[model samples]
Target: MRLMPDEHQVRSLDHQWQLGNTRGQMRTWGRGQFRWTTFDLSVERGPDGKRRIKKTTLTDTADLKNPLRDAVLAMGWSWRARLSKL
Candidate 1:
């Protein structure tokens, strides 16, 4: 996926979007409607005093692919993904 950084946000053709200090969302079409999966993002300091980004998926996504995680890793940031029960 070719993600273009627009200011503090990154967007791709697949409709993956991310904003600063805010939740991100992925949109997919299914069952004659749009399905949305949200991601909660946070930045924290790691044990080494470096910044780490935490991304938590808030809902079950219709698609199995995770472009956001791939994008974050591509940016060379310390990141992790978590699955939320909610």
Candidate 2:
């Protein structure tokens, strides 16, 4: 499936892509004191013959900082951290 974003968003994405920030690395964003992980963008040709985001696949570093666990804890869940968990 193809994903579309507005021109402003596309410009931001293009800027990131051009800077090589989205290359072989998982993007991170800060939420309060926690850093959250995000997927890498994959591009593909759309039906209209235009390039678009095909999918967002999670990177192998999902567990690097335990973002998922932090999210669960933030939601007041009784969770335990496991080794190499995603």
Best candidate per lDDT, number?
A: 1
In candidate 2, list every pair of residues with a backbone clash. none
Q: Which ten residues in a row have the lowest lDDT in candidate 1?
A: 77-86
TM-score per model over all chains? 0.31, 0.27
Candidate 2 residue spans exceeding 4 A from truth: 1-32, 55-86
| CA shift of 43, model 2, Å | 1.2
Each prediction's Cα lDDT score? Answer: 0.51, 0.41
Best by TM-score: 1
lDDT of 1 by residue, 8-60 (tens): 33332333343444354453332222347889999999999999999999885
Clashes of each: 0, 0
